[model samples]
Target: MARLAQVTSSRNREVVAGFDNYADAERAVDSLSDKGFPVEHTTISGVGLRLVEDVLGRLTYPKAAGLGAVNGLWIGLLFGVFLALFTTNAVAWFAVILWALLWGAVVGAVAALIWHALSGGRRDFLSASQLIADRYEVLVDPAHAERARELLQTSQS
Candidate 1:
């Protein structure tokens, strides 16, 4: 938190205003420009997401990772075998394996959720990416930053 404060303080001459939607952001910029205030906005991609995906995909999808796709699949297979071997219910090995797969998927989903929550910033978790691919950022001259920020804030509210 202190580090964030430092970085923000360094930009004290600049003011940041967040918008709920793109249209509101656009309106703010248009209004500022009409009032003879310089307003510039930009979008930058997040490379962290791509990097994380590359590493995870290689580890999880590697042919050498497991019997086929996952190194841990064998563990699930073992559990499945145990299920098939035990219990006089007479469950097929295939059914046990399917159950194991479902269990593995659930585990993976939970891990992903935790990871996503830990990773900061606005992100679309739908993608197998860790970082933002696009964002709308604005900049204004120091002298006009206050007015621009106020206008943007009011518009957003």
Candidate 2:
């Protein structure tokens, strides 16, 4: 005999606690898990989201060229290895790899230099962007919501 599995609807899920930050919500969930609560039944949600951009550093021609050259070097090395597999001679394999790496670095550096020069100082800064939330909520299945809240409260005490 095959038994049907139980499915809990979204309506049966409710928010047990709200936190000002994601770490706090995560800690709350961890506490619930430590208390033998089913951690899988819990979920974290961010509310009141905002996009933020943080400047890392100024981007210069030298930096841009260096980045391009490093990327090109790796790509060229990979291509060389792939090409080497098709050749039967050991010397040809080494020759192909050397030539590929040299050309790749030269081409990549030149290309990036040209690109940076063409930008004319319009966008010269490097930055990281992410979406951040003002608050994070811990939600759990209705059956476990009360227990989760109790566990979280006890942990804080």
Candidate 3:
């Protein structure tokens, strides 16, 4: 798309027509040539089809999933702090940190479990637009507008 704008703008003169899609573009060429306007050039791009697998298809989860684990771990640590401050007889804050780590591990494990369930162990992304060339854009010269239309009409009939 970027290239299209760049090329069209730079050329400024010789581009008969620029079509994002293929069908209309081809018709443009057929019609123009029929009208005695020799098609200077034709460019076919992204025509046939596109196959895009979902991201899940490639990875179990996004890297950010690890951030979730880290968050759960932090929460678990906070909970451990609460336990040590109010429930536990141990005066050492280190004990709180250790308990927090244990909880964090449990949280991380739970997260991994949840992710596995979501992905079914087969992380894949959605893919679409296998092929899309239903329409095309046509451009005409300053001189052959009516002739182009006539030619296209005749060709269609």
Quote the positional error of residue 126 for candidate 1 in Å: 21
Off by over 4 Å in 1: 1-13, 20-23, 40-135, 154-157
lDDT of 2 by residue, 64-84 (tens): 898789878888898988898
TM-score of 2: 0.63
What's the TM-score of every candidate structure?
0.28, 0.63, 0.31
| Top model number, lDDT | 2
Task: Return the number of clashes found in candidate 1.
Answer: 2
Off by over 4 Å in 2: 1-12, 57-60, 76-104, 110-122
lDDT of 1 by residue, 1-157 (tens): 9766644543434435544445555666687667666544322112123234533332222222232325345556667777777645545656777788767655555555455445553442233544332333455556666777777666557
Model 3 over residues 73-112: C-alpha lDDT tens digits? 8888878777677644555666777878777866776786
Query: How much is the lDDT of residue 107 in candidate 1?
Result: 57
What Cα-based lDDT does every candidate model obtain?
0.51, 0.85, 0.57
The clash numbers for all candidates, in the given order, read: 2, 0, 10
Candidate 3 scores a C-alpha RMSD against the true structure in Å of 15.6
Model 1's alpha-carbon lDDT is 0.51
Superposition TM-score, candidate 1 onto the true structure: 0.28
